[model samples]
Target: MAITSDDVRHLAELSNLSVTEEEIEPLKKDLGAIVEYISQLDELNTEGVEPTYQCFEMENVWREDEITEFEAKRKDLLNLAPESTDNQIKVPKVL
Candidate 1:
Protein backbone atom coordinates (compact mmCIF):
# COMPACT_ATOMS: atom_id res chain seq x y z
CA MET A 1 0.00 0.00 0.00
CA ALA A 2 1.25 3.45 -0.93
CA ILE A 3 1.23 5.94 1.97
CA THR A 4 0.72 9.61 1.01
CA SER A 5 1.65 12.83 2.85
CA ASP A 6 -2.01 13.32 3.73
CA ASP A 7 -2.07 9.86 5.30
CA VAL A 8 0.97 10.76 7.40
CA ARG A 9 -0.64 14.00 8.51
CA HIS A 10 -3.84 12.18 9.45
CA LEU A 11 -1.88 9.54 11.40
CA ALA A 12 0.10 12.28 13.18
CA GLU A 13 -3.11 14.02 14.17
CA LEU A 14 -4.63 10.75 15.42
CA SER A 15 -1.49 9.96 17.45
CA ASN A 16 -1.33 13.53 18.91
CA LEU A 17 2.04 14.24 17.23
CA SER A 18 3.26 17.34 15.40
CA VAL A 19 5.07 16.45 12.16
CA THR A 20 7.34 18.95 10.37
CA GLU A 21 7.30 19.49 6.59
CA GLU A 22 10.62 17.65 6.06
CA GLU A 23 9.55 14.68 8.22
CA ILE A 24 6.34 14.02 6.29
CA GLU A 25 7.99 12.48 3.19
CA PRO A 26 10.27 10.23 5.23
CA LEU A 27 7.35 9.14 7.42
CA LYS A 28 5.28 8.36 4.34
CA LYS A 29 8.03 6.14 2.85
CA ASP A 30 8.71 4.36 6.15
CA LEU A 31 5.03 3.69 6.88
CA GLY A 32 4.48 2.43 3.33
CA ALA A 33 7.39 0.00 3.62
CA ILE A 34 6.12 -1.29 6.98
CA VAL A 35 2.64 -1.89 5.61
CA GLU A 36 4.03 -3.67 2.54
CA TYR A 37 6.26 -5.91 4.67
CA ILE A 38 3.34 -6.85 6.94
CA SER A 39 1.14 -7.56 3.93
CA GLN A 40 3.46 -10.45 2.95
CA LEU A 41 1.95 -12.46 5.86
CA ASP A 42 -1.21 -12.92 3.75
CA GLU A 43 0.66 -15.49 1.65
CA LEU A 44 1.25 -17.88 4.60
CA ASN A 45 -0.58 -21.25 4.69
CA THR A 46 -1.84 -22.37 8.12
CA GLU A 47 -4.60 -24.80 7.12
CA GLY A 48 -4.44 -27.26 10.06
CA VAL A 49 -2.70 -25.21 12.74
CA GLU A 50 -4.24 -25.00 16.23
CA PRO A 51 -4.86 -21.61 17.79
CA THR A 52 -2.52 -20.92 20.75
CA TYR A 53 -3.51 -18.71 23.74
CA GLN A 54 -0.12 -18.83 25.51
CA CYS A 55 3.36 -19.90 24.38
CA PHE A 56 4.41 -21.24 27.80
CA GLU A 57 2.85 -23.63 30.34
CA MET A 58 1.68 -21.43 33.21
CA GLU A 59 -0.75 -21.70 36.18
CA ASN A 60 -1.84 -19.47 39.05
CA VAL A 61 -0.09 -20.44 42.34
CA TRP A 62 -2.07 -19.70 45.50
CA ARG A 63 -1.04 -19.57 49.21
CA GLU A 64 -3.03 -19.51 52.48
CA ASP A 65 -3.61 -15.99 53.91
CA GLU A 66 -2.34 -15.38 57.47
CA ILE A 67 -2.75 -12.43 59.86
CA THR A 68 0.33 -10.85 61.54
CA GLU A 69 0.39 -8.38 64.48
CA PHE A 70 2.72 -5.36 64.82
CA GLU A 71 4.45 -4.20 68.09
CA ALA A 72 3.40 -0.47 67.78
CA LYS A 73 0.38 0.56 69.91
CA ARG A 74 -2.45 2.87 68.74
CA LYS A 75 -1.86 5.36 71.63
CA ASP A 76 1.85 5.64 70.81
CA LEU A 77 1.09 6.30 67.12
CA LEU A 78 -1.52 8.96 68.03
CA ASN A 79 0.97 10.72 70.36
CA LEU A 80 3.47 11.12 67.49
CA ALA A 81 1.01 13.15 65.39
CA PRO A 82 1.45 16.96 65.31
CA GLU A 83 -2.25 17.54 65.99
CA SER A 84 -4.90 15.07 67.24
CA THR A 85 -8.50 15.41 68.52
CA ASP A 86 -10.88 12.66 69.68
CA ASN A 87 -8.23 9.98 68.81
CA GLN A 88 -8.05 11.28 65.20
CA ILE A 89 -5.57 13.45 63.30
CA LYS A 90 -6.60 17.12 62.79
CA VAL A 91 -5.83 18.98 59.56
CA PRO A 92 -6.92 22.14 57.80
CA LYS A 93 -10.21 21.95 55.90
CA VAL A 94 -9.97 21.48 52.11
CA LEU A 95 -12.73 22.37 49.74
Candidate 2:
Protein backbone atom coordinates (compact mmCIF):
# COMPACT_ATOMS: atom_id res chain seq x y z
CA MET A 1 0.00 0.00 0.00
CA ALA A 2 3.06 2.25 -0.02
CA ILE A 3 2.74 5.15 -2.49
CA THR A 4 5.50 5.57 -5.09
CA SER A 5 6.61 8.66 -7.02
CA ASP A 6 4.80 7.39 -10.09
CA ASP A 7 1.60 6.81 -8.11
CA VAL A 8 1.79 10.31 -6.66
CA ARG A 9 2.37 11.76 -10.11
CA HIS A 10 -0.61 9.88 -11.53
CA LEU A 11 -2.86 11.01 -8.64
CA ALA A 12 -1.71 14.62 -8.99
CA GLU A 13 -2.47 14.49 -12.72
CA LEU A 14 -5.97 13.15 -12.01
CA SER A 15 -6.58 15.89 -9.41
CA ASN A 16 -5.20 18.63 -11.71
CA LEU A 17 -2.50 19.53 -9.18
CA SER A 18 0.95 20.69 -10.27
CA VAL A 19 3.21 18.92 -7.77
CA THR A 20 6.80 20.15 -7.98
CA GLU A 21 9.63 17.60 -7.90
CA GLU A 22 10.59 18.84 -4.39
CA GLU A 23 7.04 18.18 -3.06
CA ILE A 24 6.75 14.66 -4.50
CA GLU A 25 8.85 13.00 -1.76
CA PRO A 26 6.82 14.55 1.10
CA LEU A 27 3.50 13.77 -0.57
CA LYS A 28 4.58 10.19 -1.27
CA LYS A 29 5.64 9.66 2.36
CA ASP A 30 2.38 11.19 3.68
CA LEU A 31 0.20 9.14 1.32
CA GLY A 32 2.12 5.97 2.12
CA ALA A 33 1.67 6.53 5.86
CA ILE A 34 -2.08 7.06 5.43
CA VAL A 35 -2.40 3.89 3.34
CA GLU A 36 -0.44 1.88 5.93
CA TYR A 37 -2.68 3.20 8.75
CA ILE A 38 -5.84 2.33 6.83
CA SER A 39 -4.44 -1.12 6.06
CA GLN A 40 -3.88 -1.68 9.78
CA LEU A 41 -7.53 -0.71 10.40
CA ASP A 42 -8.55 -3.51 7.99
CA GLU A 43 -7.15 -6.04 10.50
CA LEU A 44 -9.82 -5.22 13.13
CA ASN A 45 -11.75 -8.05 14.91
CA THR A 46 -15.25 -6.55 14.65
CA GLU A 47 -17.01 -9.66 13.40
CA GLY A 48 -20.45 -8.96 14.94
CA VAL A 49 -20.26 -5.19 15.15
CA GLU A 50 -23.13 -3.23 13.58
CA PRO A 51 -22.22 -0.68 10.94
CA THR A 52 -22.94 2.84 12.24
CA TYR A 53 -23.10 6.09 10.25
CA GLN A 54 -22.28 8.19 13.33
CA CYS A 55 -19.99 7.57 16.31
CA PHE A 56 -22.57 8.50 18.96
CA GLU A 57 -26.15 7.19 19.24
CA MET A 58 -28.64 9.75 17.92
CA GLU A 59 -32.46 10.16 18.00
CA ASN A 60 -34.50 12.65 16.02
CA VAL A 61 -35.65 15.54 18.30
CA TRP A 62 -38.29 16.77 15.90
CA ARG A 63 -41.24 18.74 17.31
CA GLU A 64 -44.85 18.10 16.33
CA ASP A 65 -45.93 20.20 13.33
CA GLU A 66 -48.68 22.64 14.41
CA ILE A 67 -49.76 26.07 13.19
CA THR A 68 -48.55 28.85 15.57
CA GLU A 69 -50.20 32.22 15.92
CA PHE A 70 -47.97 34.96 14.41
CA GLU A 71 -48.77 38.52 13.31
CA ALA A 72 -46.55 40.56 10.95
CA LYS A 73 -47.37 42.60 7.82
CA ARG A 74 -45.41 42.26 4.51
CA LYS A 75 -44.45 45.98 4.70
CA ASP A 76 -42.96 45.42 8.18
CA LEU A 77 -40.69 42.67 6.84
CA LEU A 78 -39.67 44.71 3.78
CA ASN A 79 -38.75 47.78 5.87
CA LEU A 80 -35.76 45.85 7.46
CA ALA A 81 -33.93 45.62 4.12
CA PRO A 82 -31.42 48.35 3.08
CA GLU A 83 -32.55 48.16 -0.55
CA SER A 84 -35.62 46.67 -2.27
CA THR A 85 -36.49 46.18 -5.96
CA ASP A 86 -40.14 45.58 -6.97
CA ASN A 87 -41.14 44.43 -3.46
CA GLN A 88 -38.07 42.08 -3.31
CA ILE A 89 -34.81 42.44 -1.40
CA LYS A 90 -31.79 43.26 -3.63
CA VAL A 91 -28.59 41.29 -3.19
CA PRO A 92 -25.15 41.55 -4.82
CA LYS A 93 -24.26 39.21 -7.68
CA VAL A 94 -21.91 36.49 -6.38
CA LEU A 95 -21.45 34.41 -9.54
* Candidate 1 lDDT by residue in tens digits, 1-95: 79999999999999999989999998999999999999998899979999897778876768778867879989899999999989999898988
For model 1, give the 10-residue run with minimal summed lDDT: 59-68
Give the clashing residue pairs of candidate 1, or none.
none
Candidate 2's residue-wise lDDT over 22-55, tens digit each? 9999999999999998898777898999988777
Judge candidate 2 against the unseen true structure and give its global Cα lDDT, from 0 to 1.
0.90
For model 1, the stretches where C-alpha displacement exceeds 4 angstroms are 46-95
For each candidate, give its TM-score against the true structure: 0.49, 0.46
Model 2, residue 81: distance off in Å is 27
Best by lDDT: 1
